[model samples]
Target: MLSMAIGDRIRDFRMAKEPKLTQEQLAESIGIKRSRLAQYEAGRTEPPLTILKMIALALDTTLPELEDEGVPVPRKTKAVQDAPMPNVPQETVDMPYAGLVPADSNWGDPLGTGEELPVDIKFKGENRFVCKVVGDSCYPYLKQGDIAIFEVDPGPSVGTIILAERLGDRACTVKLLEWDAEAGRSRLKPLNEAYEPPSSSPGWQATAKLIGLEFKHEGVKMTAIEPGGFRSRQLAWRGFDI
Candidate 1:
């Protein structure tokens, strides 16, 4: 079962390092704040794949080994003679992430990251945001480990799948916005029968319309282009969700 919390996996891998790196050590190595790294380890926040990928690199392990509960990959790879180098993004932003929000996580006000992560520019726009998927709530349409891109639309039309949040509860969920003509309102509908529909409260509202989704992979992020780090990996979302 993929039940292990990602935070725990990060902590385990950090400690399992030969030198047993401290939060400060790891954070420093990755160019992030120790407090931020602390939140990831403590579960106060979910680290997006961009951040998680860096963590994997610093810990001398693969991203899958840290994020997946499937078979573990061996750590301490001594050579990569036959392996292709990782594709690190040059022009990057600390793109906000929303889950594709964890299925079990409940958030508090301001929705930091808004639930956001760094994304490649193809998905960038004034209203677009990237979300890392960690649950099977969207099932066959949007699988776990898929990174979904959504366009901010506070009023997405009925029948559109959306990333929504309940202001009163500060909870985020992905579902189809269904029109209930009889009730003269809309309700969230679950496409997959295995999951329950999202809560419908007065504060419940659409935040963005689902647009794109891609399988997750390890890639470094940089705000500025580094000399000699000019390689690019232009991956399009496997399919347009909308």
Candidate 2:
């Protein structure tokens, strides 16, 4: 059976809230084509990230709130799966206080002590690099201390949840990639409810590229980042929950 589209839910909400506002009007206000809006409402196409944000804004609700289904919500918890080393190898020296180790090492048992630890590492491979997750921006799917494996490649497709450097910032952020072809622009969309949508400037827009993603590691939930999938309670981190 076909799964229920989130578009349908969005349409139902829009119609219920603004019966007088035609689809064209709504589309105009939201910066999307009227036909595209119709496609979204009819479940023919998924609404782009921008449109989703616009809809949430127009509705005076967060994206998570707009997409929330009134059901018994599941608790956000992490379960320890079998910890395995990825194909990548450690790049640091065997001795401490040297080069950086493979990011995957943080997830593995340090010194095989059998004691769980909260840490992350960064690695430089011949062709790729990796960085572990250290915060809750991608909570539920990526725990506060889960180690994420990221490829060094900087080209990620639209809708791909990726690890990318925030435009004009020293810090990095994990968010979904949204590309606009006509405008030659893109945006960084956070899964967390607390984060507001980030727009890329023309300069950063051109160079901002996806580094990689938080690969499913042991002791981490492997849920995909979807609209309204994860919720945040605070706004401490720019892209993560406090």
Candidate 3:
């Protein structure tokens, strides 16, 4: 009874799909090889709810429909149960001290705080990096001790605040970048009135640009994935949100 129940349901569902889904197509979308899917369809092996969950999603169905009648489906971790998952999961990122950011991956290593933090995945980018704002150099936009996000770029546009360093001294500073065309050099200007601007040649390059940072960490609710048995989320990798 169990053998034919799941196998027949899978085949029927696959055949009923609009334009039809082949064994290979269904398998690949669910992250399994075609042959493995074949075994499940052939009733050669019993698929755990984990695999059944993925198949249900791919087929746009529910686990109860796939399960044999009267067969007790034991409740397991949230990984297999139907429940509203929390917005943020456990993630560790190196919220580095507000300071100079480098071009390479030296600062890329995760500074583990061992605390759970939520990061929205849509904002995730390959060149993304974050640093805490140190002083009032760029006050209004980036206050002291504020979290600043930067994207790695060799040459950021002029008039942009950037994480930069002087070539001769290699001294790092967060300042407004300006190009002096006549002098053929770069100027690192401070926004605060009390701070004096620095004059230097285009001997400096921007490690990254200040794209975004958090002024406040109000809980921003994100739309959850499909509503059904155990919805999935794209876990944000070790990163920052600001």
Best candidate, TM-score-wise?
1
**Model 3 segments beyond 4 Å from truth?**
1-122, 199-203, 217-242
Model 2 gets an lDDT of 0.44
State the C-alpha lDDT per candidate: 0.58, 0.44, 0.53
What TM-score does structure 1 among the candidates reach?
A: 0.46
lDDT of 1 by residue, 24-69 (tens): 9999988899999888888888887778767775664556657766
In the predicted model 1, the residue pairs found to clash are: 95-117, 95-118, 96-116, 96-117, 97-115, 97-116, 97-117, 98-115, 113-116
Write out the backbone clash pairs for model 3: 98-132, 185-202, 186-202, 213-242
TM-score of each: 0.46, 0.35, 0.40
Put down candidate 3 lDDT per residue, 130-184, tens digits, no spaces: 5655444554444443455556666776767677766665656677777778889
lDDT per residue (tens digit) for residues 141-237 in model 2: 3444334444433565565555554344423566766777877866666665556765454222221222222333322323221221122222112
Better of 2 and 3 by lDDT: 3
Worst 10 residues of 2 by lDDT: 93-102
Which should have the higher TM-score, number 1 or number 2?
1
Better of 1 and 2 by lDDT: 1
